[model samples]
Target: MRKMILPPPPLFSALQQPAQHLLPYKTRKKGGGGRESARSSRRPQYCRDPAVHNALYTGDLQKIKSIFKDETTANLIIDSLAEELVWSAELGLWVLAPQKTHTSPLRITVSRGYRDCVKHLLLQGADVDAIVGGKAALHDSCANHRAECTRLLLNYSANPNILSEEGLAPLHLCTTQESLPCAQMLLEYGALVNQNTRDRRASPLHVAAKHGLDDHVKLYLCYGANIGHRNREGETALNSACASADKPEEAGRYYRVVKRLLESGADAQIAGRKNHTPLHNACSNCHIRIVELLLQHGADVNVSNCAGYTPVDCALHAVEDYLEGEPEKLIATLLNHGAAPINPKMLKFCVLSPRTMEVILNTYDRILSCDSWVEFVPSEVWQEHHVFYDSALCLLNQPRALQHLARCAIRKQLGIRCHQGIAQLELPSSLQEYLSLSLEGYLK
Candidate 1:
């Protein structure tokens, strides 16, 4: 497959030759084993001549005025990373590397939040659309959260949708709280609210949800952003929110994003690349609150992904400790929502989670056998929670208690409406709790 190459912005034409001259001229070696020998494996260093780089990076307005006296000097591309050390696999050694990145003075000033220098550069004829390192001045300013610089550049007619080298639009680069204002400015200036990245084809909403930026998500939705837009992987913003969260502490924020997306008519049942629904992702990631919310919003409890793994299968595959609270609550919720029973052999996966095992056991009236159930439990976990497992093992081949039998019958009768049905039942609190499959961490 051929990769599409984006042509550099027309603004780059002004700096191509002069930028090369800005590089510190390397003097030739005089002796055989002298300069050339030393240079063969040395890094090319960028010299920050006070007259040029000093004024730009430090926001020295007077110095910049004196240095960039003409239009040509104002557009001279500076070398930010002239050289670096990188591994050379063919040579089997680390080598000094020269990278080609013609950074514009406008990019440097705006990226560093040097508003005065940036304004002066723009006034002195700096091309606001200049492509530096594959990103325009607007992208650099927005990425660094420089609101003032961003506003100035936008006022100068910077292209809001210019694709960076990585194919991310300027709006896609706004991934932090500080970048919110920049995003707003871009939108106010007519940035495409539903524009997607060239790589992931992910809209700004997908990026916002994946990063748990509730404010950004809200802002995008308010601007008529597509709630059901899927990325390259076919994941909607809701799917991205559930699947991309990596920290347990961030669950609350992602929850809000999911709720907002759902409230705005985002499809909770939208399947992504692997045929994994939002519920499947929520279960796999052990997000109990999200799992319940998704289910309550009509997420399919028994739908399987492309891998033939149902939401229950995903729950079984979750890390016991990662569920934040009781892992059994989720299993119970699935069972109440009409999820299929666990295969006896798969009970081995729950041995480490005593409460979860109890919940699954209570849903069944009786087990036909106990040999696999007993052998599947690891010796150490079994020893650690002997009280729970021992009691559970005892009931393996025996008939369940009459009370448990009644609970199973009621649950089976209620079926899919079991969750809401039990809530309205005029039963005692203990009975209501029993019907809801509340965890006792032990089999009765």
Candidate 2:
């Protein structure tokens, strides 16, 4: 992974020491036999250049006015004021918090890990957690891996939890390819264990886990992250680990994080959307081992997603299930692990077997009649979701929700589609048939 190289300070100047000598620059000599050749020409220095300094710190017109009241001011005026403002701000922050600054100082001599500069600013007066362009100075120190600077920020009472303008804290910046030492420093400074970004709900755990950073995960967990906390999608840290995203390295990182969560006693059975649990997600992705581990850890086999599909049912039917292993082992594992009985009705529903609609509509009757099967699941789990009611009701003349009811002369009752996939699901056999017929008008 490449490290993030931050740009030069906000007040960047194009002033290079101009060539003192009127000649072309010499390129470094290729591997040569000469030990010492000649002294290099020194570049000319441009001092107290005001226009350049104004453009560097903030190209904003207001900022320019605040620093140099007159645009026509001499170079010395601009230079001196700009320097003073930078130092004053630095001092204000340092006396307040030695280690923290809202923004990096604009100095002729840029401070990189300058321990004394940080301390000087703090003792003289500076707010450690001051905001600059909506950023914390600690962010800059960390981004550059200036460990000494970071130490000062911590000493001065910088709030590690304060996210910067870009939604990054010292901890987030430390995760970049640069700033390992800065990350360690923030870790030492009492940064939150699972810091979250302001723009999104991803915790530091999510980022570290996504990057496959086992070390980072260890660091975050040690600091404090609720491994089971659900993000917007209601997915816990373990659920994120099992997602098959386009990035393999990221996926691997999540997998490692999931392993850690499990070891730490994360509850995989804490169910989520469409009723899917971590075990179901594990099975869906063909992570058979993860599925098994989840089951071993008390994952519910019969807990169905909103689609009313059980863990084994999802494994047996999703197009990708074959990637992990064959079906027989999956069935055996689920059964031995206390799966609901696999009756004819369940067989059709679980794998979408070739049961006619006639058989499916009557399947509920068969299950409730069987005392052995009723003990395993709610009668509704195997039945198409329905509501039956009232001696005077009739399926043909009722409200929309009661249309699914069967109207027999023996009695009048209302039944409705509750949570069943029976309404929208298309069996494999109907897929080609629909495409073949829908595209043609002959069926009409």
Candidate 3:
């Protein structure tokens, strides 16, 4: 067996003689404590000491204690840089743009989960609340999910509500499922549950909802987190849950988040800056179950956003993006609740979605024109589902089947009560299924 030989530390050779340049300085007085405020426009001049850096990063407790026996060594702040070349618009050239970070041993230990070394550094008088490159020891501990390190820091009187240089509290830093324990500790230690970010003004609940952290959201609500608190965008926890799911399959997790929020008194119809309700957001994301839940909670199916696009329109727009997720069903659900029909001009948009076209055509009694709709679908997609598209195009100048006409008449009479009225009409199950717009890939 061969042992792996790692490269030597960047500062190993420089530490032979006293590296006076790496000693701690008052970053606050110099206005250079954080990476963003100080390093935004210009790079900072700095150096690193390998002995302490190695000990902290590697969780070497004995090594940390040996050097930190000298109090000054434990509190030293080191500067590190990430080298990269980026285009500088002002310079009009690609420049060697480096990101400089000034961090302390306590922050590094907590971030890397070096629990014992963190305790040793604290015993040596390390500032538990020390800010390094925009984050404090507590912020790093929570962000990195270092539970024990977080407890030690909190026990040392670290401020759980201390805002990072980016203006995020430690509670907001707990974005992952593993960070739930850290968040619990922060909340128990008096962290504000509804603290909003400075830029987005999103609360901790918003963060948890967006990231799909079920336990984190539950814990916050248990601690009396305000469910109705809206962000700068007027998005409550429910809105965030519906809008933040990036994948169709991932929508289920966010759906659960929205369900919990609603159970806790989150309003479903509180629109955001764009007046987009939770239903609009859910339909746009192709979340059938979420859309159903919002509707059941009395969400207005016909409510339009600032852009004048209703939830039905949102569902159509989501069709191509979520082809595998059955977006057509979302449109059917909206229509059953008396949502306005799809725009005739937009019929072309659903060319790739034949089943969606079937649902819409079944809703109308008059014959639909499809002469121009054929041109909307690409040749390849049309060729792939020719049977369905052909039958769809045939209905352009012809009246729909008698069954569909009956469905249209019954639905129109029931109006908004179409969904519930048909359920208890005492009709056969097959007749009930027909009125609910069950998919057939064709109108007849």
Candidate 4:
């Protein structure tokens, strides 16, 4: 292949220059030792030899030993070229251009989990802290979840807190459950447990919570991670956990993370971006268990976010996306926890979600004059759930039965304490279920 050498970007250009130019005169004048160290730290020259590339890519230990016999050879930047389609403004058409990339032997081996090759390179005096291709060998090891290589790099005195070109520390890249060991190793080697990314200001704890890595969160907490540390968006780890619990299959894992955060004294009502509390986030994702957990931890059920949306309102908006998650359970939980009855006009939001509509309707003592809900529901959905719809419409603008009236009266008297108060009453289990608005598939 033809060789294509492009000028490095400004960041790499700065890395290639001697450090003395950027330092104070007194520091620069220290000695030849400082000057030599600076020279050694400069970016290494690129190598386009196919023999060296093959030795590094295949992890050929003897071939690597023969080729990288010294520090300079081991640290030489390896160049790789590829063809990518680029839009040409002059030609007004797409054309193929040669794209050049750079990496070092240590980074290549470390990312591939070649422990033997990595040790050999490090033993040959490779710069453990060198930033090649915008990342150090340690970053590659952690990002690829190569625990053995990570341990080897750290043992060779690699800077555990080194940031990538994106300003993310090794801990920030430990986003998967499989990377938990790498994260633990980082923390044990004096990685800052609460280190924040340069751009987002999201700490390690926030990263763990956002991915629903409960064990990672537990480990970070044990290492004294700041659970309440807010990102640039002002979101605590708890808020991130709730907001990211969007997948129904992953809801349980996120629920556990949220529970751990709340148990660790996370402020349940703490608002984040857009003045949205964790409760608002949990409800908006239709995480019933998380919503209930937040409520039990004293999350304000009636709190409104920047958009003037209560938790119930957020839950209503989420009904369509989370119908399979039993969004009605979230609505019921919010109402039981003292959320004000949703505005009658907002009932349109849950019209398609029959169960959700039923829960909201059960909160009222008397059915109001609202026929527009019939029009909001799709014709096919209305036919599918005509039984529930017919029962609800029959009771519109009419007084409820004596049993429902009594249930509503008891629920109102208990107000926010409805759950505990009903449990305390000497009523039968059936009566308790009724008072709690347990659905019988239709309103009575």
Candidate 5:
């Protein structure tokens, strides 16, 4: 994978270096001669003059005009050296290397939103599509959200579909809400909405979904983005959105993104990396609303991922992080939707989450005989909910009451229709609550 390369800082002391030092190192005449010669030959040596560096960095129009008088000078490669900690395969350790980066006057000005300087360079016959340092001027302009510069470059015949060295098109770099206009320009100039990254095969839709960019997602869908396109990991845009819905504060945004994708005909059960469906991802992150949304859209409740874990299993595993999210609601929702009961052996994950444990336990006619879960619960949590813990332990090896058994029988007969069937039963509200495994603070 290509590491992110930061733009070069100001070149105050960089130009003071000796000219010979600025050039690519000469081939070593001794050991590893062929490899050294080939490596040196591929490195482009460019002008490192301080005056041109200042002119481009500061957006000095007249100075830029003087320095770049012709097409060759207009596209002159400016080299900057910086010490980067790079992993050395030979030594098996990280070491500092003086890395030389190359960029052109057009790239510098476009990246900084210096439109006049960019216009001057372009008028001087600067190559708008010239890829120095693995990116064209259009890539920088889009990445930095320089909409005007991006429009100017596209008008000058910059390739909107150009891919960076990292195999990402400019559309893929429109990751923020502010980059919306840049993305619009790319699409207007013939950028492929479904262009996949060379490595991950992730389209701009996947990128936008992963970042929870609802506006970008809306735009892409309108521009004919393939909603079902999967990346190398087999994740569709919906899967990407669910997997990244980790922050509770950001849940609303992700929920909207997922809802929009579903509305656009995204498959809810399409599994991705590790064969995890969007339902699995939503459950694992304890995104209750998204989980409900997915189920409403026909997401399968009992689908298993590559690890043989069902959506309920994923929810159980995430209890620790989402105790405050009312994980019991998610567990109850899954059961109501006909999800298979979680294996008794996996109950340890919910020991600290008494309400979650209660919901899972309520699914069975008889509580499974598992004493190990008690040890996993911290003493503080046990103390906080001693009544529920005590009641649960007392019933571990005992048969549930006849009333509970009847409730279980009704739920079993209803099967996947538990939610709707119970509502239609015309039972009293208290009985309905009991049938739904509503937490009563202690086992009945």
Candidate 6:
């Protein structure tokens, strides 16, 4: 290599001597120690010549090769050549010798879809299963919805079902990215639809349902994916779809799939970690139509989970317009069909009413304070003084008042009864308190 010394600094000769003298005096006064010389060498060197990286950055690879013919320029330009090569490769604009960052030259081409690159790189001996960023290159192509690239890669023996670092396979990646074309291609290429991730034990259907992708869902169903396959938590994909109804577009799609799943005989009663079924999940999200669809398919509405929350409880917890009174309607339907009521908040608050009080107190084994029970009254009802009986009335077990105690709960749950017989009853203070909270929480 020919040696070339960097040119010496040009001088302002008249000020140079004076500046040198001033430097020493200023250093002492300003605390600028001689250690500053070490700092000067710490910064990176910037080569200002545009010709060096310009061709590479701009994808002018032919021009770049010509510049490299001059040995001095090549030596100066080598530092930037790798970046130029990588950028050009990523852009699919030109070919170059493998640079440092990509020493193995796994050429899953960066642009022009996934197909041609797969064919080209396969001929060049690129590894089909080479891992990049903890993902197989097949995942990148599929997730970007590159159908042809995915197909070509698959033909070259890439694993179609390998899980990425995120525990997502090409199927899961396609669902999340909403790439219907790539997902369809994956299925065509023998990708497993019911494949489970160890993390969620969630199948490809579940991933699609969670994100509410309609076409991915349909593709899975068409390919004989078990729509009822539950995750590790025992929740099915339909359950996820019902619970994740965040947007109208998603909600509508979820409903259509739920209808399809039901018609196809997928079970709606499969429970999750807390023993919550699809009905419970729908109620939690306040989807009246979904709740109705679940019930129409013979779902149990009053089934309580391990945490004492029923589909009724979940529905009552929601405040959306269509969701109002859903839990009540479902509960009523189930009750008519012989479902027994569970321990209720009304019973919890009504200690004086002996009818169901014994049963309620027996379940708890101890009285939870009057104040605690009183707190169950909705804030709106409490502010309105709906439950105003004397402290003495609460002291004794009042059995005759049982009919009266049930009134508030009935009214709060079903709305005010207009019948003269119902309006005639004098509800107890405890019962009224129960009514207040139930109504407040429900109305809210």
Ordered by lDDT, highest first, the candidates read 5, 4, 3, 1, 6, 2
Model 4 lDDT, residue 319, Cα: 88
> With candidate 5 superimposed using the best TM-score fit, by how many Å does residue 225's alpha carbon deviate from the native?
1.6
The better-scoring model by TM-score among 2 and 4 is 4
- Candidate 4 on 20-88: residue-level lDDT in tens? 232111111122212123443343566777777777878999999998888767777766676666777
lDDT of 1 at 291: 88
Better of 2 and 3 by TM-score: 3
Worst 10 contiguous positions by lDDT, candidate 1: 33-42
State in Å the error of residue 169, model 3: 0.6
Rank order by TM-score, top first? 4, 3, 5, 1, 6, 2
Per-residue C-alpha lDDT of model 2 across residues 1-444, encoded as one tens digit per residue: 122323333433444243244321111232441222343253322323435464434434444344333212211111121111122453443221122122223221012554554454444333455444356568767667677677777766667776776776667766543555666667787787677776666677766555445666677787777787776667676666655422323445556667777898788787755667887876676555566677767788888898888886775554233422434445545544555544544433232211111222221222222232224434553353212211112322333222122211111111112112222445464542331111221111
For 248-298, candidate 5 gives per-residue lDDT tens digits of 999999999999999999999899999999999999999999999999999
lDDT at 157, model 1: 72
What value does the lDDT take at residue 98 in candidate 4? Answer: 67
Model 6 vs. true fold: TM? 0.54
Cα lDDT listed for each candidate = 0.79, 0.49, 0.79, 0.84, 0.86, 0.54
Would you give me the overall lDDT of model 1? 0.79
Q: What would the TM-scores of all predictions be?
A: 0.86, 0.44, 0.88, 0.89, 0.88, 0.54
* Candidate 1: clashing pairs of residues: none
How do the residues 124-200 of candidate 3 rate in per-residue lDDT, one tens digit apiece?
76666666677888998998999999999888777789888899999999999999999999999999998989989
> How many residue pairs clash in all the candidates, one count each?
0, 24, 0, 0, 0, 5
Give the residue spans of candidate 4 off by over 4 A. 1-43, 83-97
Indicate which candidate wins on lDDT.
Answer: 5
Between which residue pairs do clashes occur in model 5?
Answer: none
Q: What is the lDDT of residue 66 in candidate 3?
A: 80
